[model samples]
Target: MSRTETAARVPTLATVLDVIRERVTVSRVELAEATGLTAATITHAIRELIDVGFVHEVGTAASSGGTPRRLLELEPTACYTVGIQLDRFTATGVVVDLAGHIVARSSMAGAQEGEPAEVLRFVADHVNDLLATAAVPKSKVLGVGLATYGPQDRTAGVLLTAQPTASWLEYPLTETLSEALGVPVLIENDATAAAIGEEGLGGARSSFATVYMAGGIGAGVVLGGQPYRGATSNGVELGHISIDAFGPACSCGNRGCVENIAGPTAVVLKANTIPGLADRLRLRGDTVADFERIARAATSGDPDALSILEESAAVLGTATVSLVNLFDVARVVIAGAAFATAGPLYRDAAQAAVDRAAFMRFAHPVVVELSDHVSDAAAIGGAVAVLRRSFEARTARSGAPAGR
Candidate 1:
């Protein structure tokens, strides 16, 4: 090829990879056609992907004309990553492969009252155990990705102004985890992590913008295919968006914040006051499970339960509509621990609210949906964060000299 031709050929393999990630499997000829590249160029890219263990020859596809073509697809196990989602009740760990499939997962008691060091040590131990079970080589393992509750120091990788977990203040999470596990660590607010995961693995993949709603009223935003972190990485705190100025105060010190009215605790607290729901659902446990039960009963046509949930949904939906107007997102994914029960109701209500209130009503319908798998979206997303960065760095340094 001439110098000008080579110069014009930007290393678009990453873009091609993104395309494949967003679609079902396809063959080289199809890929070449899709990207408007020559068959020979497609062959070289596929071979490189295969060499790096990122793509594999899955099987043969039915022939349209002459002969069957071997199918090339992502090798889910080419590399692995660790994803951890921390919450007030539990800190969960998962091992995910290149394709964002969870290979193994385990959970432990969350930090109740303890030093940050001890809590993190326990988390590290769980991750180590998961890696061993997955049997992925340490060399092939990508960095650790943390999905944590805020307020967080995203730049410093510290948990700040935590909810009653005073030990979390200014804790250097990335540094400590790196030292313990010998791997690079990336941390983000739990909502942002969910949003990233949704963009990569959920309905958001098809849409350019997404408003990712974490269960129990919190939300994260991804605009124009990028995570929107605002000024200080504390962006998209949907839970704290004010819904009522004269309502109860929220943990973020705001009266009538969305969380005070719409989070799982708030909903469950409301249910406990309702005599019929309290007796029928036996909503005594202060855990996500109890919240899930409340949501299920509400969706199943329990009057008292429905009343409690509808009120919360209206407040949450109002906040979500505001987000839709601000971001002009095309899709919204509701996920997290809260989806284990009442996802459908929230999806419908939020969709309706956005359609009625979003400023861009005439442009397009803002699609609202629930996560495919609520059980491990955060953990899997955590792992996705690692795999994404690992491959990105690899793709970037593929042409650069080592140690430069």
Candidate 2:
């Protein structure tokens, strides 16, 4: 074909593949109808995908007319991706297939609260272990998707700010991980990853916007199915967004930032000081699980525990109200180890605040729900992130992925 002819021809092959992959199964007639392409074109595209191992003939569909149609499904195991979630204290690695299903996962404890190198090493170790246990073939694996707390330079794949973490300043995360894993790496903020997970696999599947409430106070904005990762990856740092300029000094050097008033550390500090609450909640363990137990106690009517949680919930509610007003989000998904403690209380308070204070209160009621997957959401999201990139980059259509 001539260059001009080739240029004039629409490349709908990838589009058809993406739809089939996401839908999991479809008949050729359905693909033709979905793509607005002729039956011949659909046949050609399906043949190409099948020859390349991207699609397979799963089975015959129920007959609608004279003959049963063959159902085509994405060969999910044909490709795999790695995902990593890096936080202040530890890192998690997960492996997932083309369809965003987790195949294996591994985690390791480290001083991620300290420095980037320490945390990156922890991530690498976990990745190695996950790959080993899954016995994934290297040729079939696509790449890695990394989720981190950040003021990130997404294009440069670097963390732009000096964090409490040692050596976190302008760190080359993607390059380093790519060098170590020998695969392409895509990096995104934790909230962004969580938002994508929800977009791709969670409650937000049908919603255009969602708020991912997590480790620190923040919201992920997905407008029209695409995560709006601002000019910098530092978008929607609700934790740093000020609600009370003079209330309390926040670690981010801002007074009364949401994180200072409502983050896990802040809640723990406030809860521990309460009289009689410490013994009943048993907030003495090293893990966030311990804090969750305390929150559970508060939910069960422990007065002192309830007071501490209520106070923190008030702060979180205030911050959430501000976010709801700014974005008019359709749904909010609250997750993280902290929320696991008193998620119901936090969710109730947050919804109450939004109902009372959101600027668009009369438009529609925003859905507020807790993330059932908890910490696993981030890890699962990381995997989804890779599959998402692989799909979009190859197909060239930027589709918004629902949360995992």
Candidate 3:
């Protein structure tokens, strides 16, 4: 559909809520201006939101000469959602309220080497523990959002790839999780989820790209306030982009993909070749943990570790340039667990690369920064996905344009 048609179908309430969430505190006039909705429409929507306890008046903004405009903000505790980022090596779960604040979080072993049913049970248990820790009853939760690696059918809610194990292919992920958790479940790409989560967190540009690194590398682009999901909703697979055609074969049936060359797994493998570097750093077999060790050493000025990371950063920077050129996003957020230890290096490398080579650098400076919630971005984004889905459902029911 065209952007106008897409915007026309969005519910005004959802669009208004999004504006309030983005602006933190906005007046009715300001909301109308931001969303391009009629003043009467904004008033009615704000009334409905306030009546539903999703929004509340926070006092009045100073008026130039007439009546003071009442300020409104989200009522954070009005509802909650659970977001879980499940990968081969780690499972991070978080409970977030309406305002996108994480009230509680938990982490444990991933679905690695487990049967599908066993992994589902493990995730359910973790989610149960998370809600209990947050003291939130199940009734208040809208649903759960699962963020993971993809190449899957989101509409069917099944994974298509068999990365960790072949048994996961075609597994009824959302159905099983919903049944296990006693709530609705949604699945999203990890990188896309992170981008949504970043937008929900209130300080991001409406259009930007999020480069997420976990067990692998991926990117999500948001353009004109909407996520750019390609035909399959599995777009922007940055990791699989080949930096070298003749270097090495990647599991994705490609040669010299960036991930195989500079992903955590690749970095750790390269570090291990340094004869006792792994032993010196106590590198376990875990890709995530080992890479963190290497990153830490790099930060501590270990020459061998530094060299490995610098090489990886250089490759990632090259990839970043391509991403910027493709999306033309003025801002790039480098996020995920992989960057938690050595984020600054990647950030600097990406920034320098953009400054030096981006196609739009002469016209507009491209900003690159690390996520505040680097390690938990996908998990948090998973939570935000639940809220976004709720809004979409509401829009579907209302059958109205979102307006903004």
Candidate 4:
């Protein structure tokens, strides 16, 4: 059964589903222990769920001193969700089962330069293609979720103002796509959703923060296993944080923001200033691609390339130190498209910086690590966001005490 979103309105159903979903598999006794729900409540709930074809009995579990009882697990293939990572240049899609495993995935380019509707049209096509490719029936598909650049009104499913573009401002992204695809749609900032993805399935139960770098740098600080989305769901604007009072101007009307000094575009812009470097590297206009080329040169012993990376690293380190200090978080995860190619470099440089500069370095000892997986974090996060929302909806429906 898909435990995608849970609402608290249905207390018994939500509590029971929440326990089963999180534990992966559980018997009545284990479910009781995990949810603090009594045996009768679990018994009644499980029977109802099984009757509705949501949960299934899958044999029995060994007991220490008692008779074994039936084990239950979510039927992953029973439902699916489509997740898309929408970027300026490309859109990547992934179809995930109820258990949040990617069952099918694909990508297409030539999206960045189009109009808003045009871009979403292409995305809709891909969504259809993804479902077809996965061979998952539409009835079993829960919804479509999108992870896009931030500064959005998540409550309204509207893309708000953001860097490098004004076209998407106040655009009803979710509604547009939902109407086109005929499926419920959900949207989230790529950074926040990616953090949620990591928290949900990356197996980390502790409070932490994730710094995701794609077209630009952004952050998602997860506290107590939930994303700390501030007002308007635009919290953790780590890239816009000012670190260089005298640095270059940013599109956000700020000077010396991290995006201006440490972002991929910033690195490319600075690389252009190196004497004869642009022509030597055959510099391309694509900031991310150019940055990757530069990173490769650095690894291959190019002094200019190495210097550029080091400079970018220094600025990023300074900004990261402030983030760790402000949050008092001990674990920092560096992620996003930026790390797709130069992951090790980012991990090493960021780790060294936090070790050397973070406040309470010895007391808390922040540890910086690369994302366990890269390339499609945002897309995966998007799908996970849908499941999580469903989980919440079910919980709300359960009519249990709020957050109980």
Give the alpha carbon lDDT tens digit for every residue of 196-270 in model 4: 767766534357778888778888887866678777789888899988778788778788999788888888998
Candidate 1 per-residue C-alpha lDDT over 12-91 given as tens digits, one digit per residue, 9 for 90 to 100:
35435655665658887778777676777677667767878888887899877898987777877777888898767556
State each candidate's clash count.
Answer: 0, 17, 3, 33
Candidate 2 lDDT over residue span 75-159, tens digit each: 8788888877766644567888766577897665634356666566657767877888888877877888887777788778888
Superposed model 1: Cα runs more than 4 Å off: 1-15, 21-29, 32-51, 56-71, 206-216, 276-280, 395-404
lDDT of 3: 0.87
What ranking of all candidate models by TM-score puts the best one first?
3, 4, 2, 1
**CA-lDDT, candidates in order:** 0.72, 0.70, 0.87, 0.77
RMSD of each: 5.0, 5.2, 2.2, 3.8
Candidate 3 has a TM-score of 0.94
Writing each residue's lDDT as its tens digit, candidate 3 over 333-395 gives 998888999999999999999999999899899999898889898998888778777766665
State how far residue 142 of model 1 sits from its true place (Å).
0.8
Per-model TM-score, in order, reads 0.83, 0.83, 0.94, 0.88
User: Which candidate leads the pack in TM-score?
Assistant: 3
**Model 2 lDDT, residue 279, Cα:** 71
- Preferred candidate (TM-score higher): 1 or 3: 3
Candidate 3's C-alpha runs over 4 A off are 1-15, 18-25, 34-37, 58-68, 401-404
